[model samples]
Target: MCALKTLSLFLVLALFISPKIQTTTFQTIKPKLSILVDNSKSISYFKEEKNLQDFIYELKNNTRVSDKFEIENYIFSSDLQVSDSIDFLGSATNIYKAVTAVNKLNSEKKAPILLLTDGNQTIGNAYEFMSSEQKVYPIIFGDTTTYTDLKITQINTNKYSYLNNKFPVEVLLNYDGIGAVKKTFSIESGGKTIFSKRMQFSKKEGSRIITFDLVASKVGVNYFTGSIEKIKNEKNIKNNTRNFSVEVIDEQARVLLLTDVLHPDIGSLKKAIESNPQRAVTVSKVADFNGNFSEFELVILYQPTNVFKAVFAKIKKAQCNLFIVTGTNTDWALLNAQQLGFNKNFLQETENYGARYHSSFSTFLQKDIGFEQFPPLKDAFGILNFYREHQDIVLQEIRGVETTQPLISFLEQEKQKIAVVFGEGIWRWRAASFLRSGTFQDFDQFIGNAVQYVTAHKNKARLEVNSEHIYASNTVINIAAFFTDTNYKFDNSAALEITLTNKETKKKTTFPFSLRNNSYQIALENLSPGVYNFKVQVLGQSHSKYGSFKITKYQMEAQFTHAAAFKLKQLAVNTGGASFYSDEITRLTQDLLTDETYYSEQKAIVKEQILLEWKWLLLLIISACTAEWFLRKYYGKI
Candidate 1:
């Protein structure tokens, strides 16, 4: 009984006296190491596949390095992918993208990167200029031995040319380690050599530029191949040839200018519009207008009188683009009756109005021609009342006071584009521009861009599809679409479907567009090199659109012949690291293991607990009290 009572007293006192205690521990965190291996096609040129595999195997098996690091492996070419194996079969190399990917993946915890590559970047930005917080050690894979190689570096030419017109093609040739060698450069089209020339290089390493003029005779896509004859001991033949395509359109856009009387402005406007090679202008008097108006894409009217009302009606009915120049002879009452865009109350007086360029115009890019510097236009003083909203106001009138009254404006109404110039004597502006700058480029560009914008085709359908007309074979094709309600507001509640047909193979592919942030988009991948036609339609609606695009067979990997050692060195220097060759990879490993920055980090962890609330304390107290009660009852002392 005495022992049980004493135990109960001790248990109760221990609970009140106990305090919380804390224990601390320290652990070493292994440093993170990221290894990036180049799997691009260029790595295969130097037979470095086995060497890369051996290097990775040694690193992972080395206890000194493996014990210090938590490793991550990645293989990259044009894209970054996490993998345990490397395959040297990628079509192109994008070193910049690989570095960027590592930086993004380790944004929270910066890890040191070990890169193995030939540093031949055929796509994306240069990796040398990319900044990162982690050190990057680059191990070059290819030999630095110089060899003889003649490569066609670049071919510059227009992608589109008019039929029967001669276009210029410039070829850039690079020669390495060959001195005083005569090489033959040839251009072939339709499997026949059309032009050939012999060029002699005097230096062992240099670049030569060759220019040729070729006629675009056919009205279709013309594929041309430029080649340099292989040398006696040349091993790399892929870079010696390159292929490009030019689309030969049928004819230039024809523009007709109809006027009531001959004016100097007609000649000025014709010269400016025809400055572009893709456009031609013809001027004729309104009374003698007998040409086919249907053939012209755009029709310009200069102060037409009531006699040409039939011509105006025909133009409106045909829905051709119109550019109206209003002057003293303009019949405003008749023009207003047509409800073209605006109505004016003539005061029977004329005044000169200078032009002020509007900064808020969005229809087209405006030129920096200094509209304020140009001469004034002879316009009638009137109260103009606009009936419809204008798309953009290119030029506003500045008559002693700057006013919002538009002098030149573009409008779209009833699916037709109309541009109105409410004055005359624009010839004076062209003359002034030439007098100031000694060139008519600014003035010509201003007029030419405006004319092109108003005459360009406008899509008024509720269903509109947007895509580029040309794509490279390796690129993914993304087609975007938009749906509109009856009032031209965005409506995406309807499902849309597109059917793509390969023109040559007659194979069909159907895909449904997925809704993406108020629009619809679909991605098409691995499309072969050919022309494809697509038709899109909205389900349960009559809205449909059709178009075609072409993909070219071109690979960037075939253009590069040697590795870029200087770039790889620069990347190492920029990140406070060093460069090494493949044979010196061991030195890189030793250096990383010895570097203090890569050492493991130790952190201490502390924890605290209250002993009074422990379950063992409660059980002991219950047992002690029960034993004391039992003893007291047995001894008859309860």
Candidate 2:
């Protein structure tokens, strides 16, 4: 009876649960995507009817047709002022800042970006943002031609102005087109047209240069706008207009100069240095060397009385260039040791007892050589002169030299190219020129040129690496270096050693390199991945350049793993769900979203053997019959 009851229960459970198990399958769910617009400076160029806000409305309705994605919106210009009711990422329209914000998005797992830009990245670095791993879809909308229009090339004026003073002004204009084209242009300053002219350009050349001279009549930074007549089919009109700000100043490169003794020769030299703004030279009589040397890039020491060794040492240590002016009091032995002494054979000595020195433009001081002759001055005492043989240096003097020196020389020193002026008496040239106009009255220019030559060698050296984590497996790594030595002539044979040092262990390895252009590539395959500091030293015969490089800590997994897995899991848990493995994807995706009776009804199915029911019962009946037969047979008639 118990067996029969268990069979009935098993049959009932199977009948109720089988249909529910076969009811449903699974499917995937998609998330919403958001779009942000930058309605800042770039938008102002377009009319109000064609603004970015209206454009956003168009994208919203069009994107709504796709049921796979939900859309959210946000807008920003100078600041994040407003956000829609939807949860959206706020953004700054500045190209660089916007890229940074989008690159950092953590919530949206699979998102797309749409960017509309003029390609004019003014405020921030757009290229840097795009160089990263972010996916950017750009719709460029600005003018493409760079320099095919008439533009202002240069503006020459002071920074401050006087209310009604006439000042010299120059404007340079260039037309960027092949073939000759004639056009009329005008210059407007302070809301008034100061000059206008019709110009012509040759069709064969790239650009034409136009010069204009105008008078300043305002007392502020006068705004000047230059515009040429608009041409038909011109692609961009905005670029055709050029503007500049010019200030009228009471003084220009005004220098206060002093020398220890009232020497005319020294005065001439100082005056020559301050001649042009190119590199102004100023001299102060240092009764004592207490003032700051920071004000000047170059300083001159025309022989001092009771000169202290400490003073010479201080001058040597100065950040600025120092030109030592030799006099009769200078120690000749020390001068020769310092490589400033001149060979007596090079001197041009005068023998006449009664003689007059006349200043004339020497072939050596010609304009091409960078020297200008001072105005002719007579009655100068004839003296011995020890000068350079280089014709180039001579032309520089003849072009116009207000300051005169008896000796000038150059020395190729270790790590430095030193130029020395051995003798003085330059002030006499200035005094002699004052008696006559047109003698290089610009003594300031002469001295300024000399000083510039001495200090121009101090270059700005800065180094930056392209990447912080250079993979050890990488065969070669690239580095970008920037320096201010525009006139550098690099020697290709120079070699550099780059040494990488482990941060914690202090272990170091060095790689030597021969130059392949201005770049150096060192193999990194042998080095293990870790935080390392690299220092590069360039070896040159005279001077050496040094820089440092840094390698960020590297993790092998960080470079190769899929970054999206973590975010996918977070989305699953936060929504009260479990992540599905790829193997079980078909079931999890199809069934998880289906409505099922199994979850609603409490039922289960089970399987059993027939021996527990029909077979066992039959065996029991046979055994009972056999026992009765045996009892009857044993009793009487078997």
Candidate 3:
């Protein structure tokens, strides 16, 4: 009785303190079995939709299999989705994507996968090469039928072509029929036939590559279709034709390299600017140059001195873009007196400072190309100050101390977009970049982007968009937009929406954009095949932008006439799992039930519970008191 009273008093003390107590209990966690069903339109195209549905129904309804393992159902098309609804209407088949997704989501469970697919993956990397320990048991479907069909396996063409230039087109053709088949392969654009050739394919020689060239006379987006004449009674006619597009440009931008002296840096700058096929660089000395300064889109003054005074005057009057390079030979006094864009207060000596990246530079999105490790550039030793509020791409680091002085910077003050590199001897940087990255692409690309930004016209528009010209059917349209305030800073509070108008249906729809990662992003779905013209407009502002993209009437899932069982079998064998056909459901279930590799595991689950919040604990305390009192009364001690 005294012990019972002590227990009651302790319980009361625990309730007053209100301390949380944790207790660990063990429970059996059944090993998860992940089912990745290919809900792709290819199954429906192969006429095996019913067969796949029946197999899924039987497997899901099996009580014995469900009772043994925790089942996770997923479906895949162009991408993977966790779903119980199987409509067999997925537009693409990416088995590798499905398997990789399951591996990631169930990384802890290391769940065994049961994949159901025709094995016709139209996108993503190869599944057979995926490195994971989780076993993948692929239930192969659509292997029973083989139809006579000819397919345009692939079409290769360039994304852009110079005007009036002949662009090459290569078509890969494949025929699965038993005999030698002949078909008329043709190319069409704007509903008119452009090129035609007769191609032959046999069972032994089942594929052929036909290459031809077409003249790009027009200067705009040109759509083309490469197709083979369909054979008699062809079931998979969707794969008979392939559509592609090319953008034709009129001319390249002209850039003149005007320098007063000759240096290796001049060669490096010229080569870097010319690396982009769109920009042509012409090197000329200021004294010998007699061309029209305004003809060139940009003029690069290398190590400019008093000799470039007349050239700068002409360029300033022209209002053309300028990329100024200063070094040991630069006449800073004259350049500062001219007051083009920026001024540096340098001492008599030229100092060598290391480069430090500035992450807050938002004039453009550029990755740090490992500039901090490169050899320092030579600039006049002083407090290099800017006249305007400029953005620095790389700041100066004197010895080990990072300074506020700008090494490479950009400023627009005198109605001219100017980029200045307050240094020289960057030709050595090419070799240093190659030594670091095994290639000069990083350095060359950085230089090219700097030059491109300087030469490119200032886009004062408040709205900007980055998107593709074409998208495949059933793929999500991810349109990204950037809305800025009048001062050109990104505005997050702005209400931006996109209005898409279908060219064919004449129907318009609007969708709002969500803010993510400092940008306005929107994902659109269920858009039909047509050319969509979209306008991104700010709600309360008059600023708007327009663009168009074509959604092709193409489905990757319908490109298959039969299943690829061998690939799935190889994948299963590589992952320590067995491959079975849809008819082998019984054997698959038995293997799962009998395989000791899969079993429930006991795991300790520790849960924190409050002392006074448990109603059952209070009842137990009362029962203890009541029992103690009843015993004491029965013993005549009440």
Best by TM-score: 3
Candidates sorted by lDDT, best first:
3, 1, 2
Model 1, which residues run further than 4 Å from truth? 1-27, 82-85, 104-110, 129-131, 162-166, 202-205, 218-220, 249-553, 604-638
Error of 1 at 106 (Å): 4.0
Which is superior by TM-score, 2 or 3? 3
> What's each prediction's TM-score?
0.59, 0.30, 0.69
- lDDT against the true structure, per candidate, is 0.81, 0.43, 0.83
User: Compared with the true structure, what per-residue lDDT tens digits does model 3 show for residues 495-586?
Assistant: 98999999988899999999865567899888988888999988988989998898888777777888888788899889999999989999
Better of 1 and 3 by lDDT: 3
lDDT of 1 by residue, 107-224 (tens): 8675899999988887777688778778888988876666788888888887678899999999999888646788899999877999999987756447999988999999877878
Q: Which ten residues in a row have the lowest lDDT in candidate 1?
A: 359-368
| Candidate number that wins on TM-score, 1 or 2 | 1
Candidate 2 residue-wise lDDT, 263-314, digit = tens: 5666566547644433355666666557666565566666543443445555
Question: Which TM-score value belongs to model 1?
Answer: 0.59
